[model samples]
Target: MSGPGTAAGAAGRAGQSDALEHLARVGLIAYGMVHVLVAWLALQLAWGGGSSESADQSGALATLAESPVGKPLLWVLAVGLVALALWQAAEVVRWRSGWSASGDTRKKAVEKTVKAVAKAVVYAALAVLAFRAATGGGQSGSGQQQQTTAGVLGWPGGRWLVAAAGLVVIGVGAHHVLKGLKKGFLEEIDLASAPPTAERTVTRLGQVGYPAKGVAFAVVGALLVYAALTFDPARASGLDGAMRTILDAPFGRVLLTLVALGIAAFGAFCFVRARYPERT
Candidate 1:
């Protein structure tokens, strides 16, 4: 009879499967494409006389939807993102099963577990969004965010909850900034076998990309906090709102242009990661 231990071992093996790894890589490519699209939308907002579409992931997917090959691409994205989520789920299982055997400090193990869980949730959510887009059921991400914020604010003590969530997002943004500045992302990828030029390109992309993304996230989080404080859900308009906020600042056009370029760099980095990921 197979026991819990046996089941865990099976899960671990399944997580390391070659097929899943390939799918996860494909998912990374799709992820990169989304970021590229977002960068394009951001540029439009910055200088192309403004865009009707939101400058966020949902907007990017929606752009894909308008293309002739949109449905097929969306289906591919949905499948790849689901696979990526499953791969992260498998990582969580592996971490749980080998928690004691890995000989790592308890803190490190916990951190790994948390990261895996977070990735799984993020990928799963993206997969759902892609699926919805493919099915013609996609909704505006900013609008959805506003509605959700409004609903949350209606609950007792929801203001505090929202504020706490904002703080968490800010922390995440700070981490990204630190990771970029400190080259901490190098620890996550293996480039020993990569050509010198390729390695340099990847490193440069990451250095520029992470901090830009961090800034964007920080703005979003700040907006969330502001919305909570003012009891205005409209302020919680997600990424697109964040971009617009930046555009409204002094010297906004230059800043937004730089940020858009950084985002494109990040998207390009994702393509390299798809080719040489140390972990799914």
Candidate 2:
């Protein structure tokens, strides 16, 4: 009894619902791995910045660049970032492309112009960065290029921007996790479960658990920033000093453990998203 139009509509709806679920799950997986990598990088920076040893200029960038294995791993992060952007862009394009189909030609022209302009800006920036990196001009010429440390974060710099950036990423992750909680898991459940008291507790747990995890990432990122920036490199044992700083902090181990747990939870969410697919 189903007509062609009816069948087509049903197929379209199914496709859209599946796409959202896939994107959300893949996004969570990508987000988690990227943070773990970033955390490792922070440790390296802390060690290098706080060390009393001389900087390695010859293969500085090469040594730091992620390896073949690392590169593939990092592709996961790139996917999360770019896929999210493109997914959003596609939504905008879909709506606008048709709205002006029969409308004023000028409005359609403007829309096309804006999209092109935005793409150009992104391409231009990438081109510049590529040019610089290829030409060995990534670092500013500051007399011997004494190997850039976490300098901006320490002495005269205070590392405010670097630390803040990590914190901001944490905030972004929290936003996504909280959104998933509200939209993905909790919203689907029956709000009026029997045993009303248990329902409130369960609801609250779900609400706070993921968001709390995000806070953990932010906290660890902040700690790494503080250790690398504030730990003095004046002494030969300065690297040790930084490690000690972390150790000496109240409940530092506990905080690190919490960050690790957050990472694991993120991984779990990604897995669930991937395995379960999605339902409308």
Candidate 3:
């Protein structure tokens, strides 16, 4: 028999993946850039993306990136970034409406070209991320995505896009929470603290991180945007900033640190999931 959440989960997966894949399909270069945008938003919302003390504390992030540790990580990130501009442009041309309608031999040639090029792109992206992993860089977002943002969209424009994307991310996460709740996926994560069962596995897997921080990112994004709009940057918070603020008391700092660590873990999980997005 089919599980209760299966249909909902499948539909959700399709919705998310198709949208992302379509972005890549449109123009791989643009796809690379979009992932970079979302990843920065994730960093801000989930990893303490911005600061209250400074209007655009992303400079602090840049400063952090310059540290011996940060410098090496950037090196790793940069190496992985592929300028997919020319490559992706060719792909768009090859796959344009007529690509599929070509004769069988031509179609086979097109398919071969797509696969070969796509594999190279994937390899290039992975190489950059692997450097991050080698340098002991922490996972806040997929390092592959990090590579793109760090190198491609530099400075004021990049920051602006990232900040806007933060708001979009928050909205997306909130939407996920609402959909999960309506479909009863939220209940799937409930713990029994007893013997394992098929239901428990499915429920726990669905519930663990998706509902909570998915929504948390959204909240952080909204607040940060509001703060930016109100001209009160002090009100702005990312995952790190918000949690730290909430736990301002003595032991609170410790709690927030743990939360930050947890976000890093969640990001790592996503990176891993990207390697096997279809597995779950």
Candidate 4:
């Protein structure tokens, strides 16, 4: 009787684990879809197409809203993204518990936890955005960013706070660039079963995509800094605003187009991630 109960408990736990993994997989695919849409919007702008929206996450959701059966898709995306956030949270907890083999270094565990936290925040935000879209309360991510900046700027010593935020964003951008250069993203992916050609393609895509995203983030940070210095919250734009700023610069079209292409490459890499996510 004791052995049967134990077996039943073990099977239940395994089923739960399987369910969570499936949810995470769907979440990853949804994440990839968002990136791909963002890349498409960026490309449209690069080619001189007119758009009233920013090339950010909100923009991507908005684009999806315009499609047939958009609402249902948004609901699905929201569910998946929320699951992904939970997955990241689980990773953080696991790292905190030192669940890995003794060979794993403390430094590596810390790094992984930090990365997971960041991803959790992002995935949660995306989930909220998707839910809003599904419910017909969709809002612009860029606009929301500006509002937040304005609120922050209204505080005492607001300028300093804004400046600090800008610096943090810049740091994040630099990290992205570094990760790309170092091919550190490969650490998460399990490519043992992949063919050499597929591996090479994913590698190339990541190399271009990460740095390209880094550049965009850097631009956004600069704009935030500019806003802080100028006492203008309007200048504190989001990803879409950053792309516009790039396009408005000298040879802006060419520069933006190049960046757009890089972002698109990153989006392609996201698809690969969806198919072959990193194993713990």
**Regions more than 4 Å wrong, model 4:** 1-16, 99-104
lDDT of 1 by residue, 1-280 (tens): 7765776687788877999989988898888888899999999999975667799989989989999999999999889999989988877776665566544665576677798898899899889989998998968889999999999999999998888888888898898899899988776566876778878888999999999989998999999999999999999999999898999999998898888898898889888888888762
RMSD of each: 1.8, 12.5, 14.1, 4.4
Model 2 lDDT per residue over 50-122, tens place: 4322111212222223254443433443444344334434434433444444657646645544553453343
Candidate 2: lDDT over CA atoms? 0.41
Which residue pairs in candidate 2 collide?
153-159
Model 2 spans with C-alpha error above 4 angstroms: 1-27, 36-68, 90-209, 217-248, 276-280
Pick by lDDT: 1 or 3, better one:
1
lDDT of 1: 0.87
Please tell me which model should have the higher lDDT, number 1 or number 4: 1
lDDT of 4 by residue, 115-233 (tens): 88899999999999999878878568777888999999999999999999999899999988998999987765679866788789889989998998899999999989999999888
* Ordered list by TM-score, greatest first: 1, 4, 2, 3
Model 4 error, position 1 (Å): 23
The count of residue-pair clashes in candidate 3 stands at: 5
Top TM-score: which candidate number?
1
Q: What are the per-model numbers of colliding residue pairs?
A: 0, 1, 5, 0
For each candidate, the alpha-carbon lDDT, in order, equals 0.87, 0.41, 0.43, 0.82
